[model samples]
Target: MPSQIHTTEAGFELTEDQNCMSELVKLCTDRPELVLFSRPRDYYWEDVSAGEFLAEVYALAKGLVANGVEPGDRVALLSNTRYEWQLVDFAIWAAGAVTVPIYPSSSPHQIEWILEDSGATFAFVEDAHNFADLRAFLLREDGTPPLSGSASRLRRVAVFNEGGIDEVTREGEGVEQSLIDARVAAITHADIASIVYTSGTTGRPKGVALSHGNWMYQTRALVTNPIGAVARPGKRVVTFLPLAHVLQRAVAVALTIHGATQAHWADTSTIALELQRAKPHVVLGVPRVFEKVRNAAYNKAADGSGVGKRVFLEAERAAIAYSKALDKEEGPSFALRMAHRVYDRLVYRKLRDAVGGVAQYGITGGSAMSPELSHFFRGLGLPVYEGYGLTETAAAACVNHKGGQRIGTVGRPVNSYEVRTNDNGEIEFRGPGVFGFYWNNPEATAEAKHDGWFNTGDLGEVDSDGYVRITGRKKDLIVTAGGKNVSPGPLEEIIRQDPLISNALVVGDGKPFVGLLVTLDADELSRWKEARGIPASTSLEELAHNADLRAEVQDTVNLANATVSHAEAIKKFRILNRDLSEQDDEMTPTLKVKRNVVFRRFADDIEALYSR
Candidate 1:
């Protein structure tokens, strides 16, 4: 109904797989040994081509179809990030099946619920790590043997190593080489491609159904507007975010579609060196990674003993002060510019090397980013921009166009979306990027879509220029007993500005005051101790209660409080020792804080603050 789009062109004319993935096939087939990806199988780089990857997966798909996989059958792929994980996903769609991507760290219970709910006919799992867990689920939970010779729809699971021999061995249908190497070429836009489950932070996991048309819209939007314009091909990249999250999946898939051959690292720890070695033209990172780089730069520039550290700190002060003056439309004084030039060569340039020397731009998403982090990086000579999207939007609906961005907010809506705010203060979107209903949950599906409007569940207000400032999630707002409402996201972003704090969740609903539960940036805190003459402790918990550390957090809280209204100010907080992990279900696979779990676990602690 929006005038911005021509409804007659609602869908593209090309067939699903062809239009969506033809470019990817071209790149990989053209260069078979281009090191398209790096993972646990370092030795397999010799054969890491899109042609090689897809052929084996297509062969497996054909085998599955022969072994009784019908159209619309939902299949699950359980694994950590690897080229094969993506292969299985594409193969499922190529076979006219829907994919259900399960996280690598899923416990037996979560996996069981997904398996039963999705009615998965087959599964593709990573080697031993995936097998041990699945094996455990079958044995202890069911306490039954494999139903030999049974006509069960849940047939078998194929395993692929880090990158070698993407093959299949089946009971009824033995998979062969040539059959697996043929191109898998049948799919329709209307066909369901995948059902990515929502994090069960509020309730049980709800599978959001997405069609090929939905992902295609997503792929086309992000690929053309911002990412395509920004990252040139043959440039190296470092991917640290979990591929289980749709953001990484969509971005990586977009790269493949756009002819950007990339190099991936095994894990986050190895990412820095990989970037340095690869000299990546574009760096895709989350706020946490950027925060780490900033802190490390700050530490590196610090001189050990008394006078040296003071002089270095003075230079940083002068550099930042000069930058701030320029930000206000005032030309930098000649003396200040000279000071910045000196500091740039001596201090900031060394910091840039810490994050791969020549990174043209860094792309960020998944969580709200600190404006401070953005400014710090730009000051250090890397222009890191932000993006906004969700799993239901096939990942990206908006992004900052190259050479077209304002530092703070996630750039305007990308991929040609129709956006309007409903009276309920919720942002409802309608576009090709928007997905279908939640799989099989009609109640949820109906609730999420009103006419064609997909409720984003986030709150935002538009700027004069149409830029959107995301305040917070509708459900994440905390309204005090006095009727004063506060959005935790902006405040949380401010608190996370601290170099030694990784994440913070602000809580205060139906209570007199607001407080925070924080996860510290451990490595930074340890370094801070050594540099400041403070003693080191065994656990972060001990450090959290340290007088100096407590005061530092209090100062950060105080600074953050000044930015919000009196009603929204955080009066108190407690520092948490461990980062929220899968074991606690305190975070989603994408590492987003599961608010419901945190609130429930510390209900007593949250309530006690109000008594004071």
Candidate 2:
């Protein structure tokens, strides 16, 4: 297939009632006995059938309607990933309202901003901490906080961990179930399904208004594709990514539409334990999750004896070679195959056990994954298919599907989308999956759209086989004084691959040559110290100036520089005493580095690199 516009063949046509609630109704009716959700109770996993799931949604939808929720009303769900989040999301749709997801990590000001901006009438928070934060914002000044032009709209708040759903169900005692059905029936494809707010990297978040048709088209296109068929009936998925993000939200909807079972983890920290219990077939995650797993595996192997370490290294090399042969459609050598089989028993099986021992495929997104990590996973028999999209395009625009995947690129444009790059290298597309508009931001929406195409604000190219490779953010491109446009993202990805490095910021925009500011991974640094017999009492500042550590970082920089042209390569660099983190306002919720913030915070170090 060529890299140009590609569309799906017939027989995969979209349905008439493609709204989310209607699809849920059809799915429940078709597979009432099928287990849709496996939620963890006190000590055991509790299965919720399609029929039971719909029943709960009906009750919650009735509660919402009884509480004065009208069609098109904005309902906020501020919680972590749990079964309740999914229930509230569908319940909001069932009541003919739009769901507004709020990241639980948001500060009080951020929570207030989203609530006021969306004009949400009701909010569901996870626990007492979140409820307290929202209450503080609600009652900021003399029991009446100043809302940003949308205060009067919000009426009630519910806490999910404290019997809130039961209270809501009791409140709807007089409201008939038929009323909820009527609300669902009245919904059309054009109706707004959600107003998902973006995790603003530069400024305040913007709400991307996605219609029912938008999600329906993307969901159908995804579930019906040959690659998507991997998430078929009886397939189990372990989801730990935040539901607030569009990618995970789309995955949840797809699971429901395809009758796949989902097991939710309380947070990322519990993923390994949950995976062991669930033994999921499909895994959905961001790049950071895979990175952490890879790091853990590396650390484990390094902690072993010298002979064990050498054996592990040899096994990894054989696995990589075998994986490459598979990618090239060439058979592995007899010796290499035998070596890999032995390693499979020694090392590969243990790696698989870490991820529940049954993960056939993993879908990663939200950021660019290093090619090294992608190949490493594939070599372990767990191929991770990376996809690309934004909040505006309903999560996935292009993806690596089964049987026709390119390792480095994010595969072809999905069946519902037509993607092309402009003269300026900005990727643009127009498809059914495209969102309707930016909620309450007409000017911003207009600026983002030209003609019928939505500019993705990402720089990339499509290969001959239709695989798209993202180079960098158009806005984050660093043009040097020599007039060379350097993509810092690729360099940063390479630098982060070093176990000692945590995060990296590539600078030198308008400067003589490329420079970088790097931070050390605290855990990896400790491990390195222990291996070298260094005291644990060494401060981060002391380690930053250590001659041995500096030399290792220098090697990492050299490795990264080898990949780019001389003009775009790092000429000078400094290692920071501390790492960038979300709590420090140096990273977005999705772990993307906030370059401007980092630069401003470390102006002295950045200036010093250029001063010399």
Candidate 3:
């Protein structure tokens, strides 16, 4: 029988002390000299003291009020992660208005829907490109502006990279600072702070309404929990993930609340250098970032000669064994310890330097991380703590802390939430962190919540120790014609672990047998071909049809098949000429595959797989 309804509540109480603005005030007053934010200048990072940041926030808040933005109005931010994005978010809150964040990569149509749905009055865009996209969306084909009733409420647009701050400051020149302060004081915890739209994979995105109390409670719960150690006063963090995502937004707030210094890197291409320069104590990322690092390490090791390659393989074995021994509470054996010591100096040290020598911990979410990758990192002295939650849960419901961490499981619930599996095996949670409703969508809100518990739509189970292990998405579970229930997540996760494979989708629903659709890691593929003396000019499509490449992928498939029964094994597969991407609408912003979109786009290829 399934286990009894497992429940784990936070061992702490809610902080009834202050709202977000109140906390910011306290931080600025108490630690005025401390650096709160750092933005990149030409070749150096320029610091903004806590006091300075608060002043800027107040100035912008006054600017919004001066421009006729009323309390409870919506202000949208369409941009990549940057210093201005953080400032604008706080300013929106300080102005007693709700923030609506749109992904920079969102299509014009998506931009139109979100702006209209949230009734945004003002918007801040990142660059010229974003400004054009928003402008086109708000105007008609004949080049005329949207008329009265059919138009967006947006009356002003500020371009962040082009004198936007100066314009706002200029607009607020005549407005009294006392006006902005009064608005901030009048705000209550019950007021909505933001409307974060879910990355729509199956249908239109729904705006999740998160109140100030929801974020405040989440920040307090995270800081007081064991994971709070990562947020120590002198610690630093580098944030590059999309701020539109609730996870990054929550982290940004939590860091500010904890008084940790934040370094913003808008250009993700320079993440390596940024890490080295910032030397953050804690790093947060999605599984894709970690996976690429791991794959790159392996590819580099494989490029060596006989002795070097053998040493690298032996070192990996030692690391994995050492990690396993640690998990069992038994120290590494003498031989293994010696091997680890030798390898730590030779192999692991280089890997550590790549992410900056100061990083001691990493937090991964947005998707399930492979256990192999988790263990491998732990072996390198960088313990990656996996967490689980959705946009509706304010980014994190449960997370593994430093003191109580288990590999392959998204640890116990934080101090304010309770997690349990329902009768249908879906994870359900209830807490202050859970959002109250979906903006303007009563039906979705009703379907998503019951009694007081919010259904997470993820299939998972809780161990006796209360660690939750997500099995698969409840909606993505495949039921074959033979009546076998299979989850494609695990199989795909295992396949993607191979250095050459970028992504894999297992499909067998209502079919005779299982099959796969695979995409290659373009970089790794190039390196792979170069190592074998193949010409660099060889096209990816030609390589996909190569006999040798297919056989190598087959080996990965065979390994994945071993994880399941005969009925669930991938019987055949087709290598796609191009990888699924966000631009193609085949993947979500969070890098989740859009299964329905892929199915439609590759209908012919899928049919060809089963034709025989």
Model 1, 1-612: lDDT tens digits are 322221212334444555354455565677655555544443544325556665555566776776567778988888777666666676666566788888886767777778767877778787877866555334223534353432224555666654322335242145443443332344556667788877645778888788877777777776665667533456556665777778887777777656565665546767777677767767777777787776666665553456545655666576556645656676678887887788788777776687778778788888877876776666656767787777777886666656557667777677557666677766667876688788778898898888888888888755555566677899888998888898998888888877778788898888788888887887777777887777775577677677888899999899889999888899888877577776677877666788988878877767666767
Model 3, global lDDT: 0.85
Superposed on all Cα atoms, the candidates' RMSDs to the truth, in angstroms, are 4.3, 2.4, 2.3
Estimate the overall C-alpha local distance difference test score of candidate 1. Answer: 0.70
lDDT of 3 by residue, 1-612 (tens): 334544455345444446777789889889888888888788877998899999899888888888889999999999999899999999999889999999988987788889889988789999999998777445454534575555577777889989887799788878887888788788776789999988868989999999888898777777765447766578888988898989888988888866888998867667878888888888889998888767666767777766776777777777878888887756788988888899999888877887888888888999999888888889878888899888899988888878778988998887778888888988998888899999999999999999878998989999888899999998899998899899999999999998889989998889899989999988888877987788999987788788989999999999999989998999998998888898887888778899999999988888888899
Ranking by TM-score: 3, 2, 1
Question: RMSD in angstroms, candidate 2?
Answer: 2.4
Estimated TM-score for each candidate = 0.87, 0.95, 0.96
User: Where does candidate 2 have its weakest 10-residue lDDT segment?
Assistant: 1-10
Least accurate stretch of 10 residues (summed lDDT) in model 3? 1-10
* TM-score of model 2 (CA atoms): 0.95
For every model shown, the clashing-pair count is: 2, 0, 1
